[model samples]
Target: MTDKSEYKDSFRCGYVAVLGRPNVGKSTLMNHILGQKVSITSRKPQTTRHRVLGIYTDDDAQILFVDTPGIHRKEARSINRYMNRAASSSMADVDVLLFVVDGTQWTDDDELVLEKLSHAKGKKVLFVNKVDKLADKEEVLPHIAHITEQCDFDAVFPGSALRGHNLDELTKTLKQWLPEGDLFYPEDYITDRSERFMAAELIREKLMRSLGEEIPYSSTVEIEQFKFNDKGILTISGLILVERSGQKAIIIGKGGQRLKQIGRDARIEMEELFDSKVFLELWVKVKDGWADDERALKSLGYDDYR
Candidate 1:
């Protein structure tokens, strides 16, 4: 066998940022890679509002992967401002940048990402995501080449985030790019976020998934309590805050049936995540245009000063 020092020189460690436009499966990809729910997933745009870090480690390398919000060009608004800044700030002091894009097209939105990636300090690897829909995987090469021409990157990878396809290679490549360094987090560890935050996010995800777009976008979930017992029982109370009383009625539904459904679904997933029985209570309250309120935004953890 090679000497211990020689072995150390061959190992790698670094940070990889998963970035893309809204609903491009960036959150799904992060959850899949980390094999846990570090970020929330939704069909809606700008689902992730914070910088989520997921750690991956093996004998040959260690990776600190940052899951960023969907990279979108936006106008004045509290939500947009925070999402944009959260995603952008993760770019600093990173070893590599993984600029994720939907593989199906080469829209103007993609060009905007290219512009942002152009200014990033480190090397990049472009991933063409959502490839499961392709009639033939080979069809994306032309688009890949087009992006490659515009942005200089170490390599271009094509994969489906929804499926497990190409993830092994992508992970291997990302590990290879990093220089030798100490592990950032323990091998068994996966994410930096707390269970409380994740519980609230799961409630939000259920709302977004079960309810229609109009209500989901106008919604936010806050956790009031999260406690568990050795008997494998967990209790979580969440506030489903909406923008209007009309929306609140829609959320509560007939005899509070809709709220029950949302809580049921969220609790099931929480049980699976925590490996315990969960008692989830959901309350719907109209925040009355709190989306525009700076204090409401700050309380929800969208404080841009981070």
Candidate 2:
């Protein structure tokens, strides 16, 4: 163990909430920064439903990156409301707020996120993600300029989360903004979430990736069983909840092949993450209108933001 007394005076540590609209690469940025996948990601919007912590620690600083759900205009369902709340509440009590936007293209949802960012108390930083996708490189400067005019930011950076562009500079800038303090987590700890929570998220990521657009949004995962056997084979049983029987059928697919593939993909990732052999079981259950049901949402672990 390293002695805390050596670096106590100069060590920097704080929470940095990564805020953005859906599909802007906020989760991807944090995952890349931490050099691991603490938060799950997919092309689908609203792929991240919870506020996941990605801890990055070096010799000088420990950056607690809070990967939040994207703030969007949609609040029709209880889940949507929960996601918005999760994103908004994360801004509170954080040392820095990293507001990410897509390259050169801003939407109504981005405006909504900016509006939310305006009221936040933390030192705000703007990140223009996916800049590599831009056709004309000159467009980056003017686009960032336009956004900075709308609201004040401590710093701005244009980078591609997928391509690992300018991320080292971003990390260095974030460290400067954090307050000097003792470490919030152990040096080896990469995230604040438990293995069980990560298991549920890993399963959910596979669900989102495997199914079509509609089914992914209408579903959530619950870990029914998680344990280790005598020979150290970890066993996990996941119950996937969907809104209707028809959707459930689609996920399970013809001859249970789709569900089997989802289980296989999830188990492989789980094994790599847990560093042990895994026995995975999956079942789909129809939980009608759970997404819109407030009580059901609360029971399904969506009430953490409150």
Candidate 3:
């Protein structure tokens, strides 16, 4: 029988950063791995604007997964620069760098992501995401081989974040790479971010999904007020910042129907997440060029995670 000391030798705990270009499913992978929605997801690129920490703890390991904004070449806006910096800085001192990419398609943004990964100090693992979309499973080998030649990744894994394929194997490999240490968070804890932060993200996600493609990128969400009553009912007031008066009109829609829909959808999700009744008030305010202004971005909570 194995001794307790021997068992202790197998324990591991450390931070793992999930990185990739926009729309590569980094957030999806983290959310699926943790079995909770700590980060928001959308069909649109750059849906994640901040660095989100998803904590996973078990008997053998505690992996703090850092879900970073997708790195891209777009630094025209201050928010874009902030996101790139957030993703880049998260790789520092991390135990594992899990670089995810789309198996169906690879773009110049992906190459940019790889360039950033090259400079990271952590042990790297290449995740070829969305293999479930492949016409034939055998196509993955050549694709994996092609990426493996680009860098010195410790391991190359192929899986679908949406379908939950090979995630267990990826988790096992990540645990093996972690150093032996005690858990950084309690067993039941799943994220380091506050519920207030999550409420803002959830509202932003609903807005992103509801708005047209042209309007989503020019918007951001901020939680102005969050309070819980004695009856366990949570009240949240959020401000959605847009870059133009035109965008604000679009968000508000005819007779305020669009804004009401956004609030209703976001409130439903918040209730389920907090496990209590929730009242969410959403207001769309135009802050011209806020995404381009570093000071305004900081005020809206874009600079806090850094």
Candidate 4:
């Protein structure tokens, strides 16, 4: 008598890029799909500064969803151009393109996004995210009609990524579109980013949440320490690099209130995500014109990571 183990054949696998205008909830959709925060999101446009790869897998398929930076009509700095390229880079050889749109409005930004998609040659799914916030789903029809008229997408789905509305349908639709192949990532894996990367993003999310409009844009968080303790604690130390001394003062606040607030918010989220007590340490450093500095951007994992 002999015991035998079961073996399965190749499963469905493919890459899908989640692209859209900023604040359209692309990152939120991605976080929902992966069941974790793989990307930082904010109400501000261009929140995502890089192409974040989040892997979702079940018994049948593994979908590598790339949450890219929001596209804007600008050629300002090298990073802006890099972010723009990050959006299109996912299209080169992906099985699907999840083109997300804000359900709140169908203004020129939506049209501009559609125009970008028109040039992409891939199977596309139109996702009108934030449907729960919409007073009338019918209001999205004109925008949908306008986009569908321009490009022949495979399907259109109205969903609330925040509220988890119609997400099962969206997942099911994606499952159907994936091609049969070996799983790109193991079933247990969720994202390709490392612990340090996630910590940096968490810090960035706090900056986006706590800081004023100009502050987040002028600062970048860099992780300098990441270590796990035997007592189930994770310690992360990072520096907030700002573009100016004035920005540093703003981040530190009048009596270090703002910095403390950001640290508290970030540490709380980090603890939850890591499932351990997180000791987050952040410092502010002024590096003038770091945003436009090629070396600085490269070190921050922008063009190099791309």
What TM-scores do the predictions have?
0.92, 0.98, 0.95, 0.92
Please write out the lDDT profile of model 4 over residues 37-56, one tens digit for every residue. 88888887778988888988
Error of 1 at 52 (Å): 1.2
The 10-residue segment of model 2 with minimum total lDDT is 1-10
- Give each model's clash number: 0, 0, 0, 0
Candidate ordering by TM-score (highest first):
2, 3, 4, 1
| Candidate 3 minimal-lDDT segment of 10 residues | 1-10
For model 3, name the residue pairs that clash. Answer: none
Worst 10 residues of 1 by lDDT: 1-10
The local distance difference test score of each candidate is: 0.81, 0.92, 0.88, 0.82
Q: Candidate 1's residue-wise lDDT over 1-306, tens digit each?
A: 223343355777688888777777888777777776778887777677778888776678778889887777763567776777788788888889998888767666567778888888887999888888888877798888888888899978788887967888888888888877666666667787788988988888888888877888778888999998687689888998999999999989999998899888888889888888898888988887767677888988777436
- Alpha-carbon lDDT of model 3: 0.88
Instruction: Write one digit per residue (lDDT tens) for candidate 3, span 5-89.
Output: 4335577889999999999899999999999899999999999999999998767888999999989996888888999999988
Model 2 residue 80 lDDT? 95
Model 4 has an lDDT value of 0.82
Q: In terms of lDDT, which candidate is stronger, 3 or 4?
A: 3
